[model samples]
Target chain A: MEKTIIVNAKSKTYNIEIIDHGLKKLREKVQTVWSPRKVAVITDENVGPLYANQVQRQLNAGGFVVEVLTVPAGESSKSWMNLEKIIQQLAEKHFGRQDGILALGGGVVGDLAGLAASIYLRGIALIQLPTSLLAQVDSSVGGKTAIDLAAGKNLVGTFYQPDLVLIDPTVLLTLKSRCLVEGYGEIVKCAALVGGDFWQLTGQIKSPQAIMRNANALIEASVRFKAQIVAADETETRRRQLLNLGHTLGHAVEQAAGGRLFHGEAVAIGLYQLSRLFEQKKLTAVGVTEQISTRLQAVGLPLSDDELGTTDFYRALKHDKKIKQQQLTMIYLKKIGQPEFYCYPIKQVIGWLQQELSQKKS
Target chain B: MEKTIIVNAKSKTYNIEIIDHGLKKLREKVQTVWSPRKVAVITDENVGPLYANQVQRQLNAGGFVVEVLTVPAGESSKSWMNLEKIIQQLAEKHFGRQDGILALGGGVVGDLAGLAASIYLRGIALIQLPTSLLAQVDSSVGGKTAIDLAAGKNLVGTFYQPDLVLIDPTVLLTLKSRCLVEGYGEIVKCAALVGGDFWQLTGQIKSPQAIMRNANALIEASVRFKAQIVAADETETRRRQLLNLGHTLGHAVEQAAGGRLFHGEAVAIGLYQLSRLFEQKKLTAVGVTEQISTRLQAVGLPLSDDELGTTDFYRALKHDKKIKQQQLTMIYLKKIGQPEFYCYPIKQVIGWLQQELSQKKS
Candidate 1:
């Protein structure tokens, strides 16, 4: 199956192609966009041994010189230390503006390699080959590349779009059960925004095995929803803010949990919290909360903040980079299909969250 | 007097304003664009003692929480070590996304601080107040912020445009004589590209004092020329490459010289070499070489490569990042008014340069 999403960014227009087992045509598909003499395939330790050589060999056989750069696996790899190391490797290998970088792993590899490509020789061609369902559906298509900082997550980054995004869902079959489950939160969030066929499609997914079986359809629906939002606003100014639906509280929850909760789990809890807040304010209908909560539970995602530290979560929220001029702008759904951004004083939101946390504890 | 040139980049549109004493209204003008809570005024050691306090006080009086970040003077300050230090300072001060950075020095300070701002909290507001003639005319106008690498200069950077550029030509009077003279090479290159009035205007300049005396007109012309090219092509893909009329060979020359030759001086040498090459190729008129040589001599710029190692220059050229697939794309003077880009094999250019150097020695 093939789907090409036309992301009409102001710099240039590119596509995101969703294909099954597309590694065979890696060179042919890449050649359609650029004729780079040399290409660097960047992956992480976990994904490198499995797929890096195969991808590099395929490109080499197609008459292009190819090399592989592998970083350690996981989120810690997204750091300035690793960024500098990767840049040194690219420099030592003499990757120039005419060359390209193939980000061939999960979100960590994709982000770090994409950022490296964005700065190498002031900018070069980047082709993303996202392996995980999370990467294929969310991170790869948006063009937001970043590395974690001592200050916060994604504190240092640039909005650099890729020349092309290749999503091969077949790779998800090899992902850990936890990884597969974590990806559903984002897919469900995307479904909430898209609201129609995708919602029905996500609703049909009952377990982790179902996610693997329906990975193609789920990935397509999620990416299509995000692509439309990104096409409208490449940089998150107003319209694109809706995509951050559960992210504000989600980030706080994740930070508070400190590696215990997966990103999607935190986001699932964030979505549940936001729905309740909206219903309390009468901004959303009463059962909008129950509807979203039910969907989250159906997917086996965490629906309540039972284990999270309330104070730590609130503290994390305070340092969030998105907080502007003492006010926090949050995205919440009015109903299933409609999403809106609302601004409230930081103190007000903290008070609300504090009350909710205490009430739940009692 | 003030002139505002609009730079329509893909990210957003910003204005480059050339003013007699732009620093006076720095706070008021900055407030017009953003209501940043706290602002960091970054400068070099040379410029900080002179203007950091003044700029910070002005902003403070205008109700902004202002602080200063001063790095050591000169090009060495544009290093990864300093970048890490600057980022650490920003984090320590709790500079959040709603804050801004004011780059208050020459090219080095502007480039470093601009880059810092581009990555802080994923990106924050940046207002450039160029305090040197070279910065006012060249670096400050284009939003190309970068830091140097061990491999080469500007091997790592991003196309992050500033929110505003404020040029204060009066500050040039306080610059070192050598610094003041170095600024002219870029001015003359801009004059050559603009032709007609600017060319005639450049020919009338007799000395460093004359450049300082006519600083307003000279700075405006140079900035306008660059702004036009940058506006047409925000990323140096096509039309914008013309602005690099002398930079290909210039970078190699600069690299070979280490810290001995300034950027503009190397550019002057590159311009002279390119004119002679064009003349020999019959691409330019017969006396075009002499005309450019005469103009360069009149401005007290170098007319020939002296004290410059020919072998080292060729080796540096070989390692240049701009060389694409073994071919170097160079911009040369087709005539006084016209500039063109052409691709030549590296070996062919090295052979041509070698022959020319040998013939000159004899």
Candidate 2:
């Protein structure tokens, strides 16, 4: 059975339907929402061949004019060059503001395509069909669409909400084990923030198969927290910072690793590292670190990092957009289910990270 | 004397200050509003040398760290490449979410810089210091930040309002006659939209001197209408679209001219051509054509187009983001003040244009 979650953003309200084989009923689902004269299913090079044809056929069968546009798959495709090309093709196809773009791929493709939809004729309707576990859980729900610059990931973007997000756990059957585990990093973050029952549930999952078995329930809980956080602070001003609990160090480590570390793996290490900081501050109860580590390791996420040492971490933090007036905003766990924010001077943060790194090594 | 007009857009309300020698008091003005720790004055090659140094010095003297970054001047600078460079520089400077970007040039600079501000760290504060007449009167007040794509102009953009818009008409003293006239085209469109006193005022103006002498009143009136329209819609869904009066054909003609015709000049011609269509349909009163013609010609705005013939016009329309499912959404004048929207299929629009083109030639 399919479950639907409604994200009530200020500007627009959209539905996120979590299901099995949702792609097969793509036409019926779209038709139930709104009918457009034309539809463009924008996918990536990898996912396009896998699902683009099926998506196009369904929409076409529903008597809607459908065209599938594909960009090269991977993080690199989320560049302005690809954005330009996709925009050029959309123009050539004579797609108007009233038409729709179905973003059919992973996070990178969804981001690029959703951004194109946001800015195409000021703003248009966008339906995100997130195929990857990472996208299905995280990027797809928020109206935050962006393209990367050389300086940072998601350097250029807008808070443009999508009209719909269709998530199918069955699609995860095709995702690599690494990709699945990477998604769990975000899941763990959500579980920790939610605490209580969700935290208990997260502690039980041990492997990729266990994650798949519980994907529907976990996604619903995670998406509920994300949707609520997004609805409250769609622009990432205050409450939403909780979602970035591990992302502060995670982003730096991921960038420093230069492609060796997956985002979730880096985030896993970030969680472990920050847990130690929490322990020092007495923010979390005793043994919180062990519980987080146990949960992460059970899902095959890394608890230690050999790469991206302290110096690299400091350098990355200096360039982070979150740092204002030499002050960095860091999110920490008050407990497994409760997160809190702290703003520290760069000097103090550097010292803290140095201490953490040296202690870890010893 | 200085005047402040409040633009009450739904998402945010901002002030547009029209003053003489406004740039001289830049520091004082910014200090009154918010004291950003760092200020990045983003300008263009042409305007940067003229004002970037002075702006930076003033802000620096006010005890705020200041940096000036210049992009190559003109419409070409509104490319993805320049956007990437600007983002990189801001990130490298460690400019954070609480910082401010002072957009200190013409429409191109304001657009690119404003867009960069809107997405940097989700968003940063933007203060527009529009230099050109077009920028001051039109692009500055509307919160519409965009970059041109090869497909069409403003194909990628956002409805991100600025925190402040500072208009210094004295800066127009350095602008050329063509630039001055281009601005009048928009002024004419605004005057036509807002009938009565504004229309009479527009009809009275004849020369560049008159425009400069009456700049404050004219800008206030034009900006007032724009602000009201934006307040009601914010996004170009319904009422806001009326602002596109004369822009449909105007954009096509501008592109077809290949830099030969200025944007406002092409818009002036578009106003003229569409008036002719309205007259034929008897949708306009008998003297409407003569009044619009007299006003456009009196202001030295172009009333005829030689660069863009009918064939090129149709081709350009085919690629416009405004066209959906082969239908073109055109904004027309019901009378002097009232405007209406109509969507015409490509076939009908082509025939109408062909007839109008031959009629003009004959």
Listed per model, the TM-scores of chain A against the true chain A are 0.97, 0.97
lDDT of candidate 2 over A66-183, digit per residue (tens): 8888888788888878887888788777677888889999889889988888877777788899998888888898888888877778877788888778898898888888999898
Number of the top-ranking candidate, with lDDT as the measure: 2
DockQ of each: 0.73, 0.64
Q: For model 1, how does the per-residue alpha-carbon lDDT over A1-362 read when each residue is reduced to its tens digit? A: 87777888755689888888887778778888878578888999999988988898888877778888888999999998988988888888888888889999988888898888887777888999999878988888888888887667777777788889988888888899888888888888888877888877877787788888988888888887788888888778778888888999899988888778988888898888888878888897778778777777876889766554367788889987778888899988877788888999999888887777777678
Q: Evaluated on chain B only, what is the TM-score of candidate 2? A: 0.97
Residue A335 error, candidate 1, Å: 1.5
Candidate No. with top DockQ? 1
Name the lDDT value of residue A163 in candidate 2. 74
User: Cα miss at A104, model 1 (Å)?
Assistant: 0.7
Scored by TM-score, the top model is 1
Residue-wise C-alpha lDDT for candidate 1, range B175-255, written one tens digit per residue: 988888888988888888888899888888888889998898988888878878887888888888888888777888898
By summed lDDT, which 10 consecutive residues of candidate 2 chain B come out lowest? B306-315
Native-referenced DockQ of model 2? 0.64
